[model samples]
Target: MNREKTYGIGELARDFDVTTRTIRFYEEAGLLSPAREGQQRVYTDADRVKLKLILRGKRLGFSLSESRDLIEMYDPESGNSRQLNALLSKIQERREQLNEQMREIELMQVELEEAEKRCLDAFDR
Candidate 1:
């Protein structure tokens, strides 16, 4: 009669492949609201889902504040068209930044290849 999935902070970190400090930071950010089992922090499945979303948002190049706003807007209890529009604008901005970075990376790749070829030619001299 004790099968409720409540993970300790260490277990949660291992399960999520993140640091305990990361979980703590999310807690500090109000993204995770874990309960305390004595001196230990125990995370619920809902907290885990929020962590997953936060990490995914980070991977997608979202700032913490922007990601938080997006998630807050996405909540059924708090969903608003205006907030959705703000999130969409953030997505668009991220896409544009990514496009610019990709262009710079391509240019760097070409330059590196050219430099490598020149070095190889010098070795042949």
Candidate 2:
């Protein structure tokens, strides 16, 4: 007889380098659904994969809702085309947002430089 691999909450937290509270928070948010073995939470390989994706999404600046949507959209039956397309669209949107922020930061830096020059000129007089 073969048994399926399982993980405890603490084991997952250690493996993912996250706090147990974080895992619980994700569970509360409906991101992870681990089976309960009495008082202990038992996570399957699928749960582990979801946790990995959630962390990856967080690193890529995705909001929890966005990550949830993407994760929920996943369908291995259809080759995950829709999920991939949506992810690409989101990536594009994020890139555009970052570009806009960069432009704003550049403008602010120029203004600061001008202000500093004016102050230095006043001091020199």
The top-ranked prediction according to TM-score is 2
lDDT of 1: 0.85
Cα lDDT tens digits for candidate 2, 1-125: 98889999999999999999999999999999999989999999999999999999999899999999999999999999999999999999999999999999999999999999999999999
Clashing pairs in 1: none
Worst 10 residues of 1 by lDDT: 71-80
Error of 2 at 29 (Å): 0.6
lDDT of 1 by residue, 4-77 (tens): 68778888889889999998998998888899878888888777777888998899888888778776766566
In angstroms, the error of model 1 at 104 is: 1.1
Global lDDT of each candidate: 0.85, 0.97
Badly placed stretches (over 4 Å) of model 1 are: 1-5, 77-84, 113-125
What TM-score does structure 2 among the candidates reach? 0.94
Those runs of model 2 whose alpha carbons end farther than 4 Å from true positions after fitting are none
TM of each candidate vs. truth: 0.73, 0.94
